[model samples]
Target chain A: MLILHCPYCGVYAEETELHAGGEAHLKRATIGDSDEAFEEYLFMRENKKGVHLERWRHANGCGKWFLCARDTATLEVYGTYPAQTTEPPADIVAAITAKHPGWSWKEKA
Target chain B: MSNAVSALNGQEAKGDVTVRELGLTGMITLRGDFEDENFGAALSQITGAGVPDVRHFVQAGDFTVLWMSPDELLVILPYEKAAETVAAFDAALKGTHFLAVNVSDARALISISGDFANEVLAKLSPVDMSADRFTAGMVRRTRLAQVAAAFWMLPDGSYNLMCFRSVADYAFGLLSTSAKAGKVGAI
Candidate 1:
């Protein structure tokens, strides 16, 4: 069972206590955007093999959703942060870069 | 009082860990800004115990208040006092962004007490149930079997668990089966 800390409740919740919210930091492309952008928003995903940023709901725990930075290959969770913000925190990005050099997510490079 | 009978009213117990439905337990889902300066005082006016810290609880006799989230609390009181407590909260937090809802009928509170209580829970719960990790007064929102549940340890090393009313029967079955196996911390 994978254990991830919920940023809101401050508890290390197991997978059974949480629900996966899919890829994180996806920019919502509303009606005004082009068809490609809209399609990307709805279906396109990074699908990275090494590092990944995803959203998870602490469904049974605090009932709050949070973002996780981890390695898809090793299942090594770098960190988890609150989901209120539109982007990952600076420290988390740095930590990921330090562990897995040249790793990037979304538009951050 | 609610017409709901204890969920275990017709059930049989065959395990060392005793499980019984806690009937007619008054519960109020109190939602408010935890950082509000008047929040503690207003809740104290109704529930003798102040709003507990995150994942922590405070008890005043039979009345206890547990913090479920940043803005949520589960207030447990006697069924008779349920009405008065809700009224008090309404009167006190008139202009606040708060919701005091009576949820006594919507959820089932169960008491699992005994030496093997911890072991039975440990079998199904993913959270560390060892005494060193889960001490008294600490509460956790997690799954008991496939349903969402919350439980906290009592001073006497027992447990008070709460689950949705709809899943009470399923929860009881899971607890009983786990207890009957008598496996100590083997998932």
Candidate 2:
């Protein structure tokens, strides 16, 4: 079972106390956008095997939603940050880069 | 006006630990900027207790202030004083961006006391309920069995648990069952 730290309440909650909210930092397509763009926005996902960013809610704890950066294969948590942030914080990016080396969110490592 | 009643009607059970419903506790959900001087001052004045730190609670006189989140607090006091206290909060924080709502009737309070109180709670919650880890003054808002609940240890080593009123009977049943299941002998 995964153990995650909730940034809002500062509690190290286990997987049972949290709910996975899929991918993070998704960009919504505007009304004028093409059908292809809307389809990509709605259905496409990275589903990367390595470091990934996801949203999680402290469902049984503080009831606040937050973002988590972790390795999908190793289950190593890079860091956790508040949900209000549009992208991963500099520190989280730095941590991920240090271990994975030249890794970026959308680009191949 | 109609008469007010507690969810469990003050039911209790005795086993390795004692589980009892603490009827009609006054609770106020306060949300705002904790750093604002006016907010702190008004809360202290109304609840007679200062703001609690992260995952902690503080008691003064008849009130206890629990740190619920980054910008939220749960103030517990005598049931009869809930409305007047909300009014007082409104009066004291006239110009501040804050929310103080009476949640006394919307929730249920239960007490578990005995030498094995920690074990009883440890069965239901995912928290570290050892005496050294979950000592007095700390408050934890987590799941109790399948429901959301918050609990804090009193100075007397007893535990006070709070959950939504609708689930009071379920919470009571879980507590009593846990109490009767025998101690874990670890905590």
Candidate 3:
């Protein structure tokens, strides 16, 4: 079985944990003051096949949040971090909000 | 603020031993800036393991140090060891800004083992339990049947579920139903 390094609980048996998020690093482009730009940001993803950062929860462990990097192709994980330490890149955040008009970070939170 | 649990009222069920399966696991809450030299060393001395960094967990045999928040930790041990552990921890932090509380019996922990355990949990939680995504030795604070609980995946396929003792009775029903339905995985 693949070893999942939970940014929170260390490495654990994969069958008992839960995946909670995708890598939040994609950027959205502004569409010349158009709502389409915002919409694009709200409904897009890379769904890449290589190393991807994601969020996971040890649903049965200590109950904490953590980040993880994995190889979608081989299902091999590279590393992981606590969610607090893994902030979405600023550019990606701006793009996503720009693509989705009225989709400000405050609103998302 | 602490969440406390009272003894269960006089309620009975079929085959229900008079003792409300009200599982009680005492937890000591410790909060401090681990970066502080004294704090780190003191915690390690008491727990026999370094204080876990942000969002991590450190296990010293029966003692589990879970990073509950940025500066908060939950130390869990068997009830019988609570006194000794707390005393050692308290002495180590004689002059620190750390907070240690005796929360023994605050939460009830139940071990749900067997093949269908994951399936039963899936019915009530949205977490992805596929082996690669989430694994054993990990812990997460989440909800079950909309009730708050901490889920711990042990090295074995069993799940250690911890919830406030106040809801012990309610959780028992759900767990029993799931087990009877064979949702707890193969025994």
Candidate 4:
């Protein structure tokens, strides 16, 4: 039973109450950008076993979209934030760093 | 919406629970900024109750305005007044980014009373159904029996559960089966 905390509804919803949306916070590459950039935007998505960020929707609950930081292999959820945020909140990143040391994500030192 | 008998219309299968399909009750889905100066007052005018905050409801007579989300609410009114309520809201807020839709015909409401109503709902949903966690006037938008539904708990301990009209049969079946199963150990 995978449980996710929906920031909007303020409820820890089970997987049945949620729909998993794949990657989060990807910059769109449109016309005038190089083919490589467009391909990277459309085709290249992360399938990480360590720390990762993804989109999720509380479809059966409040029907709001949110973001989740989790470890894919261990299924240990670090935290969840609203989807409108352009980046993961600081505390979430810090929690992921403290648990899984030497993790690599975008723009994280 | 439809006054047709629900799938579980007359079936009372050995339990203290009394499940009845409520007649066509009016419903509207209203979306607006509660922070807007004219929003709450206009909603109160239509529903005859003070505007409720998110995850709660304000009761007025038999009508209740339930807060569905930060910017959305469900207005429960008389069946004949569903369209009238939406029209009134549209006329009231003529220049706001709001959506007032009449959903009376698109949803189904059923009531389950007696001692087992709480337990039956708890079995089907992830919400905390205890009296302390879900008190009166608290409206929760949660899943009921594998379908999306909203629960409005009244002060008398009865519950009015609403779901999409298309899933009325499924909702009724799940509720009846769960109600009966709670009565005895066997199916």
Best by DockQ: 1
Give per-residue CA lDDT, model 2, range B62-122, as digits (tens).
9999999888999999999999999999999998899999999999999999989999999
Q: Give the alpha carbon lDDT tens digit for every residue of B40-104 in model 4.
A: 78877767887686688888986888888777888888887877788999999899889999888
| Residue A4 lDDT in candidate 2 | 95
* Error in Å for residue A77 of model 2: 1.2
DockQ order of candidates, top first: 1, 2, 4, 3
Q: What is the DockQ of each candidate?
A: 0.81, 0.78, 0.12, 0.66
Query: Given candidate 4, what's the lDDT at residue A56?
Result: 94
Kindly report which residue stretches of model 4 are placed more than 4 angstroms away from their true locations once superposed.
A102-104, A107-109, B1-14, B183-187
Candidate 1: tens digits of C-alpha lDDT, residues A1-109: 5889888999988778889988998889987799998988899888888788999999988898899998889899989999987888998999999987876676542
Top TM-score model: 2
Judged by TM-score relative to the true structure, which candidate is superior, 1 or 3?
Answer: 1
Quantify all predictions' global Cα lDDT against the true fold. Answer: 0.84, 0.92, 0.62, 0.82
Q: Please identify model 3 stretches exceeding 4 Å from their true place.
A: A1-93, A96-109, B1-24, B53-56, B184-187
Q: Write the per-residue lDDT of candidate 3 for residues A1-109, one digit (tens) a residue.
A: 4545555445453534454565543355675755766765777555765545566765544456676655578776545556666464555345444544443332333
Off by over 4 Å in 2: A30-37
What is the alpha-carbon lDDT for the whole of candidate 1? 0.84
DockQ-wise, the better of 1 and 2 is 1
**Is candidate 1 or 2 superior in lDDT?**
2
* TM-score, predicted candidate 4 vs. hidden true structure: 0.91
- lDDT for each residue of candidate 4 in A2-107, tens digit (9 for 90 to 100): 8998887687888888999999888899879999989889998887767789999989878889999998888899999998898888889899989877655774
Backbone clashes in candidate 4 total: 0
Highest lDDT against the true fold, candidate: 2
- Residue A26 in candidate 3 has what lDDT? 37
Better of 3 and 4 by lDDT: 4
